[model samples]
Target: MGRAGHRTALMVAACAALLLAGCTGAQGTNGPELTNTSPVPVSPGSEADPTSSPSSGESDEDGDDEAGDDAPEPSASATETESGPAFPADTKPDTAEPTGEGETFLSVTDVRVAAHDGYDRVVFDLDGTGSGKPGWRVEYVDQATDDGSGDAVRVDGDAILRVSLSGTAIPTDSGVEEFSGDRIEPADTESIDEIVYRYWFEGYTTAFIGVDDAERPFRVFLLEDPMRVVVDVRH
Candidate 1:
């Protein structure tokens, strides 16, 4: 062969070799071929089963129901707890019932008025057991009668008053004399004519009298618990 023809043939052989090398490089760079071992089984009617799987934002509603069942019940109020056996709200209790009893019980048992020496002597009987202490007052009342003509023997605002005490077993004259003022004297000596009124303490009982005038329409109350006497003078 001539030199030019031989060179051209050699160039064609080199070109064919280069083309084969490029094809092999492309196959190697594309990565490995995969093989299938088993087929993935598809479930039938899975979409129709409500409990099969939870959706993206869903939670178990049964947990919420259990929490509601476990919650504690509410408590009652204090008013409801104290509701039974109470006194009626609007009623006032009666005050005349005997708060204390016995011979020495110094409750005001009775009262009477008598005219003596131009003075009205209002007497009281202390029926309870008490030694009448100093905190006693002789209040008086004065009002004209309906006729308004004759002088009504109403309890004068200014009246002489005295207090004494007696029982089946009489209290001492000295005890009765102790309560009288300089102007007033004991009613001319006697045993308890009536239960004028009685008030008692640890070792003493007292009866009361008006040296002057006691306000009329009078009521007497003995507060024995605290040892007090309230003489109400009404018109």
Candidate 2:
């Protein structure tokens, strides 16, 4: 062969060997191989959808805020109202106390009269050794009368309220009159005019309450602790 031809053939052989070496690695792979272990970073515009639903933890916080804004306040309706007690108006009512049906010594201590919104109240305080209330019957009479002799007792106002108590007497077992105050208590106010102290005889006593109204409705009741009889007259 000629010299130039020989040189051209050698160059072509060397180029082919280099190409074959590049095609295989040390483990004898067929083509170029990649062992990329690092993760590829994404661009800003290629991030997740901006309008998508949030994660569970973030979603719960957002939902709570929305629900709180929509929550309702307490109701002020009248249907959910408080209840109260009912009391009687005028006329005779059930006996308020156990003031009668027993035999015991009762003495008068003090008498007080006061005017109220719906009625005029008269309180008769009784002092006794035993634990018993004085039984009384209060009725409207033309005139009050003195005990035993039945003499007419003059009291102020047009109507007289006779109070006859059963379970008590003025003088105790020691024969001492516990009450020394005046029998006629002047109360020139409201329906009541005067309070009269009647006589005590045979384990019994009588008194009078003078009110201005003749046809007024009245209620009688008894109190404890200090034992007193209360008369309420509707104005």
Compared with the true structure, what per-residue lDDT tens digits does model 1 show for residues 62-104?
A: 5553565678877653222212232233312212333322333
The number of the candidate with the highest TM-score is: 2
Q: Candidate 2: list runs displaced more than 4 Å.
A: 1-103, 174-177, 183-188
Give the whole-model CA lDDT for all candidates, comma-separated: 0.37, 0.64
Q: Give stretches of model 1 more than 4 Å off.
A: 1-215
Cα deviation of 143 in candidate 1 (Å)? 22
Q: Go through the candidates in order and give the clash count of each.
A: 33, 2
Clashes of 1: 33
Top model number, lDDT: 2
Displacement of residue 137 (Cα, Å) in model 1 is 17
Q: RMSD to native for every prediction?
A: 24.2, 15.6
- 109: Cα error in model 1, Å: 20
Candidate 2 residue lDDT tens string, 39-117: 6765443335444555444534347646756889765422112111223454433332334445456776666776666
